[model samples]
Target: MAVQDSPPVPPNVATTGGKLTGSLGVGSIVFMVVAAAAPLTVISGTVPLGIAAGNGAAFPATYVVCTAILLLFAVGFTSMARHVPGAGAFYTYVERGLGRPVGLGTAFLALLSYTAVQGAVFGYIGAAVNDFVVSHGGPSVPWWVWSVGALAVVGVLGYRHIELSGKVLGILLVCEVGIVIVVDVAVMVQGGDAGMSTAMLSPGEFLSGAPGIAMIFALAGYIGFEATAIFRDEARDPARTIPRATYLSLVLIGGFYTISSWSVVSAWGDEGAITAATDNPEGMVVDTAARYVGAFTGDLVQVLLITSLFAALLSFHNVLSRYIFSLGNTAVLPKQCGRSHPKHSSPHVASVVQVATAGLLIGVSALAGLDPVTEVFAWFAGVSTVGIVALMLMTSVAVLVFFRRSRVDDRLWNTVIAPAAGLVGLAVMLYMTAANLPLLVGGSSTLAAVITVVLVATFLVGVALAVVRPPATVVEVTTQEEKK
Candidate 1:
C-alpha cells in the first residue's frame, strides 16, 4: 500500500524533533556520492586486480554492463523518492512496499555494507599513507596509527554541516578525476604500447577468464552511487535533486571507469595488460602514469590517491551516520542517535558513534596482526559488495510490488518494466558475487563461508528485533488500504 497521507502516531513520540536539515543541491549531492566511489583508488587499486584475476583486458566492459543494470534500478528508485522521502532511503522504500520487519532487515544489511566499506577504506588508506611516508625518507609509522589519525579528521567533518563535507569532497574529487583523465589522454595520444584497440570490448573477451570475479570488482566501484537517497532529508528540492544526482552520479562514475580502464589496458598493450597486472597489480597504474606523463605526475597521483581515500571515508561517514540517525528516529536504535546538533543540524551523535565503531574495528584488526590490505580491506570490501548487491535486488522487487499494489504513478516503464529488468540484472550479479566470494576475499573458501554466514545472521537479527519490538513509527498497511 502507498504511504498514508497522514499516519497516526503516539503523542509522546516526536518524529520531527531530531530531524536533520540542509540545503544540498544536485551538484553537492553528486560530489558526496561520487567522492565515496574514490576514482583514483578504484583505478590504481581495484582495476589492476580486476584485469589480472578476472577477464583481463575485457574487465572494462563490466562497468558498462553494471551501469546499464543500475540505471534501470534507478528509474524505480528515484520514482519512489518522490513519494517516500526520508533519510532511511532503502529502508523507507522497502517498508512502504514490503513490511516493517523486512525493511528493518534491509536497514541492518545497509549498515553492515556501508560500515564494512568505510572500514575497508580505512585499512587501505592506512597502508597507503605509511608507504608514502617511508618512500619519502620519513620514519616508518605503523599503518594503524595513520588510520586512527585519518579517523579523527573525518570525525570532525562528519560532525559539522553537510555542505562543508560536500565542498571538501568536491575539491578532492576534481583533482583525482583530473589526474586520471590526464593519464588517459596521454596514453591515448601516444598510440599506447601497440596502438589503441577495441578488441577488449568484444562480448567474447568480457566472458573470458573468471568474469564473475571481474563483475564483483566493477560493481564494487559503484558502491556509493546508490546512496543518493540517504541524503533526501538534506537535499534542496529533493524530488528534483535526488533523481538528478542519482542519474548523474551513475553516468560520471560509469563513464570514467569504462574509459580509464580501457586507457590502462592500452597503456600495457591489450595482449600484455593481463600479465602486467598479474605481476604488479599495486604498481601498474602508477608505473603507467610515470611512463606516459612524467615522474612528477606519478608522485602527484600517489598523493591524490591518499586524498581520494580520505574523501571516501568522509562521504561514507555521512551516509552511515544518517542511517543510524534514521533508525534512532524510528525507535529501532537508541533515541540519542536520532538527535541532530542544535547548531549545525547534523547527526552529530550518530556521527560520533560511527567513528567509535570504526576505530574499534581498526584496533581489533591491528591487535590480531591482520595484514591491513590483504585481510582487513579485502575481506570487508568483499562482504560489502555482496550485501549491497543483495539489497538492490530486494529493492527492485519492492518497487514493483509497491507500485502495483498502491496504484501510485501507473506509468508502465517506470513502475513495471524498468524495475523488472533491474531485478533480473541484480539477481545475476548477486549470484555471481556469492559464487566468487572466495576470490574477492583473497582466495579463501572458508573465509568466504564465514562472511556469508555473518551477512545472513546480521539481516536475521534485524528481522528478529522487529518481530520482538515492532517500531512504533512503522505503521502496518492493511489489505483494505491496498484496495483503496
Candidate 2:
C-alpha cells in the first residue's frame, strides 16, 4: 500500500506558537523516564513477586537481559532520533519510516499504553495510601478518594511548566532510589545467609524458575525508558541530549534493578530466597530492611514506596500530556489542545484532558468494586505492556526501513545491523508478552482476553480513522517561545 499523504509542514512549523520550551538537559530527561519506571516500587514490590513467581535467585539477570535488548533497540531508536523531530517518540518515528496511517495507529497505541500504565499506578498508590493512613489511625476513606485527591495534585503540577515537574520528579526519584541503595548496601554488609557472590548472575540460576514470567516482570520496569524521545522537543540540544539520555537511563535503571535484586537474593541465600519470597512476597524487601537496616528504616521504605508510586504517576502524566499535545499538533485532536500554555509553556489543555480521563477510569474501576491491585492494576498493566511491546517492535522495524531508504548514516551497525537485531529481540519479547499475558494479569484467562481485545480494537480504530479521515492540512504559524 502507498504511504498516506501527510499535510505539508514548513521548516519553521515545529517552532511555531505551541512549541514547548527547550530547557531540559539530559539529566532532566533521564530523571523523568527513570522515575516513571519507579525504582523503589519495582525493587520492593515487584522484585519479590518476580523472584517468587519467576526465576528465584537469578531474577536480577532478567534486568540485565532486558537492558541489553533495549540497548540493541536503542541503536536504531536513537539513530532515528537524529533524523526525526517531534514529541511523539514512537508515533513520529513510525510515521516517518512506515506510513502516516501506521504512524497514526501507533500513536493511538502509545496513548493507550501510557494511559493504562499511568492509571494502574494511580490505583496502586490510592489503595496503598488508604491502607497506610488507616494503619496510622487516620480517617477511614475509600481508596478512590485518595486517588481523586492525588489526581487533583498531579493535575496542578502538570498544568505548570515542564521544569517544575522535572524538579519535583528529581527530588522524589532521589529519595526513593537513595533509600533502596542504602538498604541494598546494608544487606550486603550484613551478609544474611549467603555472602555476596556472582552466583545469581550465572545463566543456570537466571534460567531456573519460569524465565518467561520473569522476563515479563523485568520488561514492565523499563516501560518508560522510551519516553526519552518523547521529551526531545522540550530538551536542550535534541540530537545530543536524547541519545545520551536514552543510554543513560537504560544503564542506570538496569544496573539499579539488577544490583538491588541481587541483594535480595543474597540476603536470604539462594536456597531459601525463593521460599522467603513465596511465603511473604509483600514483606520480602520490608522484612529485609528491618532485619539488616532498622525498624525505622523499614518504615521509611514503606513511606518511600508511596512516594515512588507518586513519581511514576506524575511522570506518566507528563508523558500522556505530551502525547495528546503532539497528536493535537497533527490535527488528530482538538486544536486547542495543540496550543501550549502562554505563560507556563506547558500543554495545559492536554494535561487537563489527561486528568479528566484518569478520573473517569478511576471512577469506573471503583464502581466495579474491583480489587485495586488485582483487577485495576494488573489488568491495565498487562494491556499496557502488550501495547508498549508492540509499539517497540513496530518502531524497530521503522528504524530499519527508514535507514534502508535514506541511508542517513553510512555505519552498517547504526543503519541496518542493530535495527535488525532489535527487531528480532523485540519480536521475541512480544511473543513472551502475549504468551504470558494471563500470568502477568493475575492468571485470569478472561481478563487477559478482554485486555488483549481492547488493545487490538484500539489499533483497529486508529487504522479505520487513518483510512477514512481526510488528510490533515498543515498551517504555518509565527515562531515564539515563552520566557522561562
Which of the numbered candidates is closest to the native, going by highest TM-score? 1
Error of 2 at 379 (Å): 0.9
Query: What is the per-residue lDDT of model 1 for residues 219-298, given as tens digits with 9 covering 90 to 100?
Result: 99999797898887788777788999999999999999999999999999877888889999999999999999999987
The global C-alpha lDDT for each of the candidates, from Candidate 1 onward, is 0.88, 0.86
Q: State, as a TM-score between 0 and 1, how close model 1 is to the true structure.
A: 0.95
Best by lDDT: 1
Residue 444 C-alpha lDDT in model 2: 85
lDDT of 2 by residue, 1-484 (tens): 1222232232333555567775899999999999999999898778988889998888888898889999999989998887666678998889888987888889899999999998899889988898888878899788899889889999999999989989999999999999988888888888767787466658887788799899989899999899998887788878788999999999999999999999988888886888999998878898988888888877788899999999999999999999898877777777667778878989899999999999999999999997888878888998899999999999998888888888868899988888888889889899999999988888889988988889888887877787887556655432112111
Q: Report the C-alpha displacement of residue 25, candidate 2, in angstroms.
A: 0.5
Error of 1 at 215 (Å): 0.5
TM-score of each: 0.95, 0.95
Error of 2 at 165 (Å): 0.5
Instruction: Report the poorest 10 consecutive residues by lDDT, candidate 2.
Output: 475-484
Per-residue lDDT of 102 in model 1 = 87
